[model samples]
Target: MLPLPESLRPSAERLFADRLGLAERFASMLAEQGPERGLIGPREVERLWGRHILNCALMADAIDPSARTLADIGSGAGLPGVVLAIARPDLTVTLVETMQRRATWLEEVDAELGLGLEVVRARAEDLHGVRSFDVVTARAVAALDKLARWTFPLVADGGELLAMKGGSAAEEVDKAGKALAKLGGIDPRIEQYGVGEVEVPTTVVQVRRRAQGTRKGETRG
Candidate 1:
């Protein structure tokens, strides 16, 4: 295989050392799919490592290692979903995408990479599977409230929902608290981190489903 492009070596080395190889694979996959999906246009290939892969990886770090089943909504270009599956082979990921073509691309990537995963060509409302995942993650999808409504039900009674966001995650986290509570997830915690010269602004709106069901630090409201 060709050497990793010079531009991405720094980011790739960092991510790889962190054991986040999925980040690298997802960037390469986007480069491959650009011809067909048009999501990562030609101009994007060089920057995919830092902009896309690193951006998506921010969520993978927040996910507890204990999480088993992950449902990623609006998995366009398969952000953290595809990254998570590749990074953590032990974790089963169900990527939910409304667009048929994107889902097809995801399936193709999974098959080509031999990444064990499932892609569902369905929208949040159309999904009939109930409370079935250990974690639900949405990246740049709908607004926080809507994402809560869309993803929470897919989380099992003791699972959690995490919405990855930018800007003052504090404000957005507060705005979505009520919605989260109603869906069986507890209030969220704001996570902050940075990489290189770029400030990786991220907000994780995480709600614990329940605990019987309750893990320590997770309480029923």
Candidate 2:
């Protein structure tokens, strides 16, 4: 098992609080099984705490306190999905992955952690029109334009898509402008979390779905 660095201990405690042990166990599972299962690269094991776990845990801060449902698309290794569920027990999280092996691993983690996650083995596009959630998120999935096409429809009216991104966040958002406009996404913005806690803060591109009856390009009053 990869050891949680002391440097990250305070951030972990701040994010997971009483659930820190569960986070530790999940980290152990990932460190032990992730590379062998192809869920994460072998190189990732060394920085699992900073680069993966805590990086994901901090996104919990961006989530709306009133949001009750969330879905993580392409939730391979359950980055923010499992991490969010562990952090906010109040949320009903669904992990959506098309790959059989990754979905199976998610199920195993859910069962092991008793997180009550709904693991769906289907592509994010498949759920369009069939299901929606208060918040939809994805990490390391695809570039912003294509990702918005797949995930924005899953965002319920007035809800948001909180996509984890990298330095290219602004570039991606600019590139996705047309797609966002057509998809009824409004006020797209980039935000960072865990500043001062981690060596690098997590960058997120947040886009809210226009509420029902709101026309595209119409400002909210």
Q: What TM-score goes with each of the models?
A: 0.82, 0.97
RMSD of each: 3.5, 1.1
Clashing pairs for predicted structure model 1, backbone only: 210-213, 211-214
Q: Per-residue CA lDDT of candidate 1, range 109-209, in tens? A: 88877778889888877774643788888888877777788887888776788887777467767877788776666657776544443334345766677
| Candidate 1 backbone clash number | 2
lDDT of 2 by residue, 78-195 (tens): 9989999999999999999999999999999998999999999999989999999999989999999999999999999999999999999999999999999899999999999998
- Provide the lowest-lDDT 10-residue window in model 1: 193-202
The number of the candidate with the highest TM-score is 2
After best superposition, candidate 2 residue 219: deviation in angstroms? Answer: 5.2
Model 1 alpha-carbon miss at residue 86, Å:
1.1
- Candidate 2 whole-model C-alpha lDDT, 0 to 1: 0.94
The regions of model 2 sitting more than 4 angstroms off are 218-221
